[model samples]
Target: MTLYRATAPHGVRPSPNIWNHTSTYEIENRAVDPDGQLAAALREVASWRARTVLDLGCGSGYHLPWFAEEAAQVIGVEPHPPLVQLARRRTKRLPHVSVLPGTAQQIPLPDASVDVVHVRWAYFFGPGAEPGLAELDRVVRRGGTAMVIDNDGTRSTFGGWFRRGYPGVDPAAVERFWASHGWSRRSVDMGWRFTSRADLEAVVRIEFDHATAEAVLAEHWERHGEDSGGEGDSGLSVDYAVNLWWREY
Candidate 1:
């Protein structure tokens, strides 16, 4: 079930996949980064332990509890009212974690209020996200770190599918955008391992349009017939590449 608002807030770009297919999106979340490489990389740059952490575009508050475990204070900001409600419900028991209704272009927090900012697969995409970057600059204190994670469409099995799905996104331009902004990029290799083929297909369908999803699944099936057993026992595993863009304020 999806919730609808008569008029969405300004600067809010609805994500239909997550908004309409929340349960399937949850499965996608579970299937991503099983190795914890992204988390490890974030800690290596700036540890959030005992510091205030802001999770931008934190949908359904999936990662809020994880941050709350180490961060002295964890704030999850999302623009969608339904998602904001879901996030609040998820972190209701955690005193250190708070969910707020806000967008990347206009965050609700005060200046220099956060020590670390985590943005994963959110709206901080390259080129057109200057407003969000400005908001990041305003909220992240001096010496604080801000991390943005996005798919590296230059490599990996999932990368190939991503490139095909969104032909407009240029890998070179994206890299240049981050470099020009003084943000450093770290390429991390991760993998999606699903427990069942049905789970894998469901996640892929939400990620891409119908045709692209079908083609991707067909290619995947050809490459590794049922149960290609490697790192993933279920045989539905795909290598994924991601760029971790970060900067110290």
Candidate 2:
């Protein structure tokens, strides 16, 4: 019944798009990276100013404006039609920004055109992302930096929940995959701080399968209930770990 079901690209792997619901995903974006630490670090390393930047899998273009503020030009590529539309609308006023419907496997940009490429919670995770990585090799210019921000499911409370929700994922294997690919990892503490229990629950619901979501929520409540005053408290914070994997070519 989701809008993405009809318009999603064929022969593409399903992303961790949180049940394909954009509204909840927006709440998640707001709850994450409250201090702008991730952005600051990325800017420090990539230094996109006066350069052309590409945001692959840029759903809804949430970070496009920020990139446009510094980059000489910004391009957002997303496969989901509805999200691509939203991204275009979000950046309509920014003449230096463009949002196009495209998948990571087939980025709609010229070879060696981008100075920096960024993918956040998108593709280029674990197995089955070889095609996208190849595409990155083609699109990014020589000396360009490619950055991928993904959950480091090896440590932290949020990582524990992620491991419980998806037992099939091998954190060690994922780490090795990136390490073998010539990418360097930088651990980032981009935790989630929700303003209300409703926000927290909603995020959990989308993050996991129905049964897993329930189990995770129950575990969270049971562990923090007493200190949080029997579930009436609106605040919820989970220590999270993420890997900022990047490579300079």
Candidate 3:
């Protein structure tokens, strides 16, 4: 009786982050993008106010409440079972918000059903995401906008760190793929500011592979010092760069 099985063939795709470790991912979300730059970009693309919005891979429905504030209806689609349950609980108070277990490859929505689709730091990563793009064409109505936000691992301190951890990801190539497909890009300056060294380390550990996480942490402490800061506080901040890709149907 799951809509996900019908939409997502070959089963659910693997997620980079450990959504099972909810606390770790939550800290990561809080630590990143303290500024409202990403939200501003989304607003500029398409105001969800009074419109139907689809949040693909909306783990735990973190941003569902914000979208529900203005959107007439908000659909949060996540493949993970526990995360889906958590998302439902989180949005139980908001009648307009509904969470479903699904994948980006096959969105469980009708044709031309949504007015605005926003995907931020989700599973529609770089290459081999054409299926999701096809779904967008089917679900997004005319004049509707589809936006995707991802880390620009090409420049800046955060980019450098990401490159060190994931040498396989080619930011330039990813940009090219989007451009070739007629998606426009906008660069945003975001950053990670953690309250404590433990917080910083915890977020990093989830972000990268085990070996890469250890290496990155070692390098981080080496550059920033073991104390994180000169004083007693263990706070750390790193400037991050991101790319916002969008297209209109």
Candidate 2 stretches with Cα past 4 Å from truth are 1-11, 16-19, 226-235
Clashes of 3: 0
RMSD of 2: 2.5
How accurate locally, in lDDT, is each candidate?
Answer: 0.88, 0.83, 0.83
lDDT of 3 at 24: 85
User: What would the TM-scores of all predictions be?
Assistant: 0.94, 0.90, 0.90
State, as a TM-score between 0 and 1, how close model 3 is to the true structure.
Answer: 0.90
Residue 224 lDDT, candidate 2, scale 0-100: 78
Query: How do the residues 1-249 of candidate 3 rate in per-residue lDDT, one tens digit apiece?
Result: 255346544536655474546878888888777888777878988888999999988988888999999999999988878789999999999999999877777888999999998888864556778878888999999989999988888887778878987788888789888998899999988788887787888888878888888987887778767666556543488788899999999
Q: List where candidate 1 sits over 4 angstroms from the true fold.
A: 1-6, 226-234
Q: What is the Cα root-mean-square deviation between model 3 and the actual structure? A: 3.3
The numbered model that scores best in TM-score is: 1
lDDT of 2 by residue, 1-249 (tens): 355666666545465553377888889988898776787778767999999999988888888998999899999998777778899999999999999888888888888999999889874455667778898899999989999998877898888888887788887887788888888888888888887777888888888889988987877878876456335553487788888989998
Where model 3 places Cα greater than 4 Å from the true spot, the runs are: 1-11, 229-235
